[model samples]
Target: MTTSLSAAELANLVTAVPGVRGIEPGIGSTLRAIGSRIRQQDPRQARFGVVVEAGSHRAVIEIGIDGSRPVKEIVRDVQETIIRALSEAGEHDDASETRQDSDSSGVGNRNTPQVTVRVQSLL
Candidate 1:
């Protein structure tokens, strides 16, 4: 489930996520990191792998984060990191914290930005 995302973007996501440790930055920062490096022919997880699903406007990339990390924390980190990456990549949703109504679009099919996280492992 490697991706076409950028390395710098992936590293930043992993570094910014709270509770993420021993996150081999050289390997990848987030699911996108696992994806990016694999895209370039990384063989670290040649057999054991990530599985992903996506929609036209969003994606659900899965990874095997170890057990110690709380699911809540992982979810928050993923959301935050995705938002940060999207913002950095210029994918603006124009969601202003002060203008809730005008920013609902940032949440989804309604035009807002949003992310959904799922923990598929602790191995």
Candidate 2:
């Protein structure tokens, strides 16, 4: 069996990363919500800027960040931390829970769930 991450769970994961001030609303999400409304569905709130796309057994996380930290470094750190969390969940038979190490770029480490981080603002 595989573990699935909820939007709230993902949000918590992102916020826990060091230097991450907060998750901003993704630019495209607003447009998507408007489009969905046209289809007669209630407008859904953006996933705290953390868009999660789940595949057969993994998830792709896209996050928007607002903070006064180095953009590249913060992004990489977030990716690594998220990947680690997912990996841990995959391991524990309890089927629950949740970084970036220097040796690896932490981009596509386990190739399980891919992460993309966008810097929206500084401080």
Candidate 3:
């Protein structure tokens, strides 16, 4: 089952990751727009940030982080986390349907949102 996550839900998920301070300015609204586009994912997944299409179910995320962590590592972690979240949401949304075995991540499904993380500042 494919599930949808809202901006608040996405934001919460992002914030839960270690080192994330908060979203950069103007980012919250961008996330909200993404969330609106995914209104069908899961109503319950509406507690955090949202996903939007930036050409192809893609979202660009701008974040502020703590300067203590290694920049490369933090970026990697964010990528993995968002991917995992999207995968889980997709699985949930497709829970009732039969699935095919493939190497593609869940986000690769039709119209699945892709996330872009931009570290605006290390505070």
TM-scores for all candidates? 0.43, 0.59, 0.64
Alpha-carbon runs more than 4 Å astray in model 2: 1-3, 31-46, 56-68, 92-111
lDDT tens readout by residue for model 3, 30-90? 5565565477543443322334443355655567899778877777787777777776777
- TM-score head-to-head 1 vs 3, winner: 3
Descending-TM-score candidate ranking: 3, 2, 1
Better of 2 and 3 by TM-score: 3
Candidate 2, residues 1-123: lDDT per residue as tens digits?
133555567668788877787776556544554554577643222254655444433433445555556678788888887777766655563333322343765355553666667666566
TM-score top scorer: 3
Model 3 ranges with Cα > 4 A deviation: 1-3, 26-51, 98-113
Model 3 is weakest, by summed lDDT over 10 consecutive residues, at 46-55
Q: Model 1 TM-score? A: 0.43
lDDT (Cα) of model 3? 0.63
Candidate 1 displacement at residue 82 in angstroms: 0.7
Tell me how far the alpha carbon of residue 55 in candidate 3 is from the true structure, in angstroms, after superposition.
8.7
